[model samples]
Target: MSIPALDAQGVRGPAPAAAPRATTPRRSRPAHAPGRVKVWQRWVSPLAALAVWQIASTTGLLPQSLLASPSTIAVTAAGLISDGTLPAAIAVSLQRVAAGFLLGGITGILLALAAGLSRAGENAVDPLMQMLRALPFFGLIPLFILWFGIGETPKVALVALAVSFPLYLNTFAGIRGVDGKLAELARTLKLGRAALVRHIVLPGALPQTLVGLRQSLGVAWLALIVAEQVNADAGLGFMINDAREFLRTDVIVVGLLVYSALGLLTDALVRLMERRALTWRRGFLGE
Candidate 1:
């Protein structure tokens, strides 16, 4: 027998097939969904590391002399800061890095442009750059000390040398890698050399040039540390060397932390500059 329906006010009939089911399972959020992480997500691992370090230090698992606790490092750093040593050292190192990087970067760009555009320039300069790039920056330290007499000049020169080759190579590669059809079109259009280079070449090569600049900046920062460590009268590296001599592990720890922080800051700035410079390079594979 068919089921009977009551009036609208007192309906007692089977529900319609189209009736919404309140109990239906809603879609679950993805485990690896983008933007799911907090803005401060990167701090989690570092905070965990600090906690573990604090625990290890409290338990004496790590010798005080060998691995100073975070508190000790902080105290030492504050003392250094209060005495103006840390700031002075940082300033000196940064000045050296800036000078060297600017000099080397300009030379690299000019060399790369010449090589990319001229066969003679490439034949003359590329071999020398490749050889120089292959040589270790540390290996030149002694030579630089000898030639430049272990002064600020030598340190700056060494850092500059360390930074130049990568920029040169990447820039040259970028220029060479530009679309051949575009070049041919420019030629067919009777574009002047200056116009072609300014409008076509520079834009085409900019993305890779930015990559090179980022890479070179990292190298420059590393080289600056090494350079500062070499009989330096004043710098973070010198502080580290001095701390080692005095067996002040806390001081040593402070120097290292400062170095790491400075490196991170510089690298971050370079990355920001890269993002700004290469805004036209969005959505590429492996970006």
Candidate 2:
């Protein structure tokens, strides 16, 4: 028996060949799409600059007397490392930096807290702070030398002075910028002063405080460098000066690069801290 074709019936019309199902187009991702990390892209500029620098130095397009090549700097750094001089200097410099940073940071945060939280405190502390901040930190070098001598005290003091102002300003601003609504809410909730500060004040101020920390750290480095350069028995700056006296451009470049690397490293550390601290923050990371 032969089956009858459905097309013969106008009601069915062979079901119209099931009509081709429409397909969704595959989408091309945007360049900045999250989770797409192009790690190599980050190095392109630095590597290109290095290539240009190497070429310039080797081909005599740039004078070596002025600019040392990366390779030469690397070799010089290795020599310094072998002699243990660089490590010793690094340790001393880092010690001074740490001491200064701690002193400055503590002083700044405390003052900021006192002033930001109370009008009386502000009246007492803010004027002196503002006045001192107006004075160039480097200019204090001569006075510090006279008072503290060319010892570690002056260097540490300078670094502390340098670190304090940024922290103080940022912390004060951050605390003051906390939403008044939150304060009122805390009052409404009958929260104690301590509780209000713990829950509402500090957390809210963290973003700006971190920014201040970064600035303060940069200042600490700057102050250390300037102080060490001015009069130092030992430090990275001392090495640079010694290298300068001997016309060891390579060594000078090495010390300079080391300083740059330290700055970058410290900045990176703060950035890492920021990421961890602000994980609750909503932004491009979607966190």
Candidate 3:
């Protein structure tokens, strides 16, 4: 037994057990998780792919008529830049997509809010949306063209139509999937609907809503491609078609690459938003 320890005032008590040092909890790193790779490492595969393509082109291993190699495509792309056709097409296409995306995205979010917030809203809105959602978004090109004519209106409308469904579905599901207990707690706190949505509902739905945004963007690009291909267009699609008539495979390849790069760029943007928006979560992303 330990003897009591007395202070200057002469207190009697069992010797205070050696005070255990306060320790901070150590965070465990995920297993088999290598540290973040360098940014250049992410480009390794694509660079290697380009190298292979270049080799094949230089060796004449691939038919230039059928498949223009990376170097040829690069040369064509450079020429297009010099000529300004490519740049103008890019501008026109970007304008159409931006307009369509804004219109469709807003419509989707609003409808989702209406449906998610009330049973009556769901009954009134969901059926019509579902019916339209059933129709192939691209297939409506004919109708859109007939109604809006073979113009920018049909192209933009097609993109908007294609984009809206995914956003609506994902936003609706995300809002509805929020924890019921949280809703009850909000009610107990006498939170106004506006405050309730701002503080809890919207935050809960953000992850999935972002997912929908990504999907909608992808669909928007797809719709743009199809819509542009449908008529006498002033976009990349038109350029690609014109190149086909000239048997300019390199130009076609360049157009395809530009489209791909646009998709990748936009996807990267959304991913950046996701990382920023979901910073509070701790998981695979290590946010």
Candidate 4:
């Protein structure tokens, strides 16, 4: 049997061997890892689809009357842009959407705050909101036109209506879904009501509130499309309607493309906002 080794105030079977120092330096991952897909790679699929569409249109597999060739639509879009028709229409549409979004967003946040902060407010507000939400908002077009007249008021109102529900629902859910432990901690910390809400509750609820904003924006566009169809003399919807009467499929396609592009642009803006606002968030997607 081996005899134990003894040191000052210590005893051991054998002297401990020194841990070997690492020969190779440890490699650390970059703070912002590269995306799985390259930037150019992301565009490949869309470009391929566009090429196929152009080929089909050129080969007469797709009829021009039914769907214009991408080239023809591009030309039509260029002409409209040069004539300032597209810009004017876009401006009008944008104004309506912006106005409506502001109004609806304010209403939603207020309602959500009220219901989220108070049981009595929730009892009074939630049931009516839920009932209103159950109905297809698009179905309210006739009623809106009658009440607000077949003008800008009805169009703006429609967008507002479309925007409000998503925001209200999501904001309410976010407020309620705040971690109970965090709220308890806030209380334990002796946080004032204002301080608790400003620091803890609002920050915690912000992620879902932002999600609601995105959804509301999407629905707002859809509502604007339908609203503009009602007695619209200007805007993309009017442009499409005018093109339809003249059997100008190319022009119609251009208008539709513009609508799609706008939707994508707005969504991208929201995504950028999320990246900036939610820097603390890390999930599978972030990796």
Candidate 5:
């Protein structure tokens, strides 16, 4: 018997329709790397610029006497390294910066905390701090030399000045910016002063404090450079100054390079510390 065509009325169908094929699974593209190109790009521009400078100096487009080539600078730096003078200078400069930055940053934070927490403290201290901040740090250089006499004392004092204001301002701002509601809640709960600060205030203030710390570190380094260069001293800054006097532009360039590299390294260290200290701050920019 032959099969009849299927219809609405009813008849035998040829066969059931085959099930539709499923679509091929989509393949995901690989994830793009974060901050990769930025790393290379930052270096590329500087290297290219240095190459152009080297070419200009080599071709006499810039006079050798006025602008030293990279190779000459490298050689001069190598000589200093071999003789150990550069290393010693760097060590001394770093020591002064460390001592002063620690002392100043700590004191500033304490004072700022006091001023921010108590109206009486603010009234007594903030005015003097403002005045002190307004005075150019370098202006005190002469007095420091007079009192401390061209020793490490002057260098340390200068760095301290540089470090203090940033820390104080930032700490004060952070403390004051703490949420009033939290304070009220703490009071309602009958939390002790220490408990209130430890739980509520410090965590809230940490991000701003880190920012101030980074800024203070930069200022400290800058101050160290200037302080180390002045009067009867040895440092990267002094090396640069001395090189300029003799027109050893190569050595001067080397000194400058060292200063730049050291600044970058220290900044990187601070960022690493920040990342570790503020684990909760991840996924948020500027935290």
Candidate 6:
């Protein structure tokens, strides 16, 4: 047997070899991780519902007068599209919505800025706004008709009124909710009033403002539907009203679907804006 090596102090044996590390098996990621879900999965429920509806209609369980079959509605929609009627109505509705949105958006932002920036403005503006918000806006249709008449003005004004409150409330809350420490830091850095507002306040309030925008858009469409009932000669509301006179349930359904589609499109646009604008924000939903 070989003798163990020793030093001047007479230590006996070589250091024991280091133990080998145990390897752990890696875990496979969950299929349901954020953004990992397939796009088709989202449509499954809606498609299934639609299929059930079609089957029910085909089996005569669902009456056409109550709600037309999906196939009938689809055919009617195609006919409307082939002619210029649907396109013209859509254009008119789009114009009205655009005008109302612009008018209301500007008014809301200005009011929010005024109230948020000054105690005097808040005292002067907020009470009136609060009182107005308390009242059902639809109740003002008669007053609006008296003031602006049964023309497009009243319709647009009603939509504007509906759109304004949400934005104003949200923007005001967002401005007030901004971190005071950030404002203090801004002051510490000697930021001017304009610079502070432009750089800090507006950017800080944007997320809430976008949320308000989505709410306002939904309200706007609802308002448009009600407003158009008051003597609209052109637009989806007019088409629906005309269809009601002739008992054309499919046309009415198509009009309602168009309204829903518009609302969804607008909401989707606001969501996209939120994603782009709030890239820096990380909430419970991981990117």
Give candidate 5 regions above 4 Å deviation. 1-45, 283-287
Candidate 3: segments with Cα more than 4 A from true spot: 1-61, 283-287
lDDT (Cα atoms) of all candidates against the true structure: 0.80, 0.86, 0.84, 0.84, 0.80, 0.84
Q: Candidate 1 residues 1-287, lDDT tens each?
A: 01112232123222332134424534222222222354367679999999999889889997787888888888888988999999998898889999999989989999999899889989998998888778887889888888999779988898788778879989999999889899899999999999889878888998788888878888888888888877898887888889888778889888877777877787777667766666665456225
Q: Candidate 1, clashing residue pairs?
A: none
Model 2 misplacement above 4 A: 1-52, 55-64, 283-287
284 Cα displacement, candidate 1 (Å): 8.4
lDDT leader: 2
User: Quick one: RMSD of model 2?
Assistant: 14.3
Name the TM-score of candidate 1: 0.82
For model 4, where is the 10-residue window of minimal lDDT? 1-10
Question: Which tens-of-lDDT digit does each residue in 208-268 have in candidate 6?
Answer: 8988899999999999999887778999889999988888899999999999999989988
Error of 5 at 281 (Å): 2.6
Model 3 accuracy (lDDT, Cα): 0.84
Cα RMSD of all models vs. native, in order, equals 13.0, 14.3, 13.3, 13.1, 15.8, 14.8
Candidates 3 and 6, the one with greater TM-score: 6
Question: Which portions of model 4 miss their true places by more than 4 Å?
Answer: 1-61, 282-287
- Please state the error at residue 218 of candidate 5 in Å: 1.0
TM-score of each: 0.82, 0.81, 0.80, 0.81, 0.81, 0.82
In candidate 6, stretches whose alpha carbon ends up further than 4 angstroms from where it belongs are 1-52, 55-61, 282-287
Candidate 2 residue-wise lDDT, 1-287, digit = tens: 01222223322442333233213222223212322343566678999999999999999997778888888888888989999999999999999999999999999999998988889999999999999999998998999989999899999999999999999999999999999999999999999999999999988888898999999998889999999899887999999999888788898888887888899889888888888898787465453
Query: Model 6, residue 40: displacement in angstroms?
Result: 6.8
